[model samples]
Target: MGIVTSLLPFSIRCEPDGDVLCAHLAKGNRQIDELREQPPTSVLFHGPQGYVSPSWYATKREHGRVVPTWNFVVVQVWGTPTIRDDVQWLREQIEELTNAAEKGFRMPWKVADAPEDFIQAQMKGIVGLEIPVSRIEGKRKLSQNQPDRNQAGVIAGLRETGQEALADAVAEGRRQPDDFSLAK
Candidate 1:
C-alpha cells in the first residue's frame, strides 16, 4: 500500500501472505517516511478493464439512447503497514515473489541465480512490509448493468478490439446471478 515514488522509476512490490499483505520498498523511500508518521495503507488491485462506447450497445442502435461506460474488476485491501528491515525476511520475500511471478514463464529465474554477494547487496537496499488485513472489498463493473443483448454486444466489441481477456470477464459476469445478495 506504500506509494513509492522517486525520480527514478522504482516500484514497490506487494506480496500477499494469508491475512497480511507485504511490500518490498526502498530503505529511504518517501512512502516509508510517510508510513512512519501514519501507518494506515490501502492497496488496490485492478483487473481487466476497457472503455465501452455507446456504439457497443445493442440498445443504442434500437432506440438511439445509450451512454458510454467501462468494464473492470478491482479489489481493495485496507490495513496498517509495518516496515521490517530484516535481511532474512527480505530474502525470503524476494524469493517467494520471484517464484510466484516466474512460475508460468518458459524459464523461471531464482534469487540464487545471481552471486550471493550481489544478492546480499541488493537486499540491503530494500525493506519488507507487513500489513495486517482489516478489510477487503471487491467489485466487478462489467456489462451487468445492461441487458443480455447489450452485454453480448459489449463482449463482441471488446473482442473486436483484441481484448479477449476483458471480453471473457464480461462473459463471466453475465453468468453470475443478477442479485448478488448471497455473496458475503
Candidate 2:
C-alpha cells in the first residue's frame, strides 16, 4: 500500500464506554479513500513545538559548542480507521468535538444552534472516523539532554519569545525522574 498523509482536526476521549479518536473529513477526501483501501493507519498529534536557538543555551557562552535544536511533544497512534456515514453518529461526534473545542469560551456554540435542515445538509457532506488505537508512542524533546543551567536558560529564552507552552514543557521535562527517556 502507498503512504497517504493528511492533516485532520481530531479529538480523543477515554471513558468506560471506550477510548477512541474521532475526526471528520469532507466527502470524497482522498485520505478517506486511502484509509478504506488500507485499513492500517497512523495518526500523529503534535503538541507544543518550536525552534530552540543555540543562543538559548548557557553552554553557548561557555564554549560556543551548542547547536540549534527543536523542542517538541508529539504522539503517534496506529490503528485501523472505521468510517461512519450514519447521521446520528456523525452528529454526536461533531457535537462532542465542538463542545471540547469551545469549552474555554464564555459563550460556547452548539451544533444544535444551527437550523436543523442546515445541519443535516452539512452532515451529508462529511464522514466521521473512529480509530481504535492499537499502538501508541510519544516523544518530548525539551532540552532534556542539556545541563540544568542550560535548561533554565532555554526556558527563559522560550518564555521571552512568548512560547509559553514550549517553555512549560521544558520546565516539566526537568521535573521528570533521572531515568526518564525523551521517547517512550
Candidate 3:
C-alpha cells in the first residue's frame, strides 16, 4: 500500500472493530475519493514530539560532540479501505466520534444536542470507512541512544521548559526499555 494522501482536511478519527480499523470521512473528502479508487492505504498517527538540544546531553561538556536530535512517538496502520455509505452507519459513527472526543469536557456534548432533523440532515453529508488492518507499526524515539545519565539530563531540561509530557515520555521509555521497540 502507498500513501493515498497526507494532511487530509478533517482530523481522522479511527477505532478498532474486531480485525478492522474503522474511520469516518465526509462525503466529498479527498481521502474518500482516493480510497474508493485505491483501497490499499495507510493511516499514520504522530504523538508527542519535541526537539532535544545538544546542551541537554550530560556528555556535552565531556567531549562537546553531541548533536541536537528529536524525540517522538508515531504509529502507522496499513489496510485496504471499505466505504460505508449507509445512513445508519454514518449516524452511529458520528455519535461515537463526538462522544469520544468530548469525554474530557465537564459536560460532554452528544449527537442528541442538535435537533433530530438537523442531525439527520448533517449525517447525509458524511460516509463511513472500514479498513481491514493488514499490519501496524509503532515507534517511540525518546533518547534511547543515550546512556542513563545523559537521558536524565535530557529529561531535566525538558521539564525546565514546561515540557513535562515529553520529559515523562522519556522517563517512561527509560523505565520500559523492552516494551517499546521499532521491530515488528
Candidate 4:
C-alpha cells in the first residue's frame, strides 16, 4: 500500500517477455472500480504513445486519400491474477512501485502521513495482485508490411518525431513473422 505510492515510476514487464504496460495508480487502498486492473497474470502495459499517420501504413500508398491509422506497441500477458490481503505485503508493493515512479517529481505521496481514516477506508479498495504468467504476446505494429524503402521512410519519420524506439520496433516488426520458427 505504501511502497507503490511512494516509489517513482518503474517499468513492470510481464515476467520475461511481455511489453511494458502503462503506469497504474498503485495506491494499495484505491478501490477496485476506480482501477483499471486486470487478472493478475494478464501481462498488459503501455506507456507514452502517439498517433501514427495513415501515410505510414503500407496499404496507404495505393489510395490517394486514406483514413488515418495509429501505430503503437502493446504487450499482453495471459495469466491468472491473485489478490493478496496481507497488509504488510500490500504496503510494501505500493511503496516499491511509488518510489520507482516518483524519482523526478518534487512532491511525492506518502502512505504513512496519509490520514488513517482515509487510508483505512482505502484499504478495502486495494488488494495485492499475484499474477503467475503463462503466455506472452508482444506486438509493435509500426509499418512492417511496406517495402524496405517505405519502412525506412516511416522509421525516419518516427525518429524525427522523437519516436525512435517505436520506429525501430516497427521497422523490425516488418521483418518478423507472427509465429516463431526453429530457424530465423
TM-score of each: 0.84, 0.90, 0.85, 0.57
lDDT of 2: 0.85
Tens-place lDDT digits, model 4, residues 1-184 = 2212222243454545543332223444453332335434344455334566657545466665555556666755555544557777666666667666667788877677777778667765655655455566666655555567667767777788998777777766787754331210
For residues 1-184, what per-residue lDDT tens digits would candidate 3 score against the true structure? Answer: 4454645322344445535656577687767777776466777777778999999887998898899999988877777887889888777767776777899999998999899999988878877887666677788899999999899999999999888989999999876552332321
lDDT head-to-head 1 vs 4, winner: 1
How many angstroms is residue 91 displaced in model 1 relative to the true structure, after the best TM-score fit? 0.4
Q: Compose the digit string of candidate 2's lDDT tens values, residues 1-184.
A: 3676778888886856556788999987878777666477888888899999999888898999889999888878877798888898899989998999899999999999999999999999999988877677788888989999999999999999999999999999777642322221
Q: In model 4, what lDDT does residue 84 have? A: 57
Any residue pairs clashing in model 1, and if so which?
none
> Over all chains combined, what TM-score does candidate 1 have?
0.84
TM-score of 3: 0.85
What is the per-residue lDDT of model 1 for residues 91-169, given as tens digits with 9 covering 90 to 100? 8778877887789989899889999999999888988877777777778889888999998999999999999999999
lDDT score, candidate 4: 0.56
Using lDDT, give the best candidate's number.
2
Off by over 4 Å in 2: 15-18, 177-184
Ten-residue stretch with the least lDDT total in model 2? 175-184
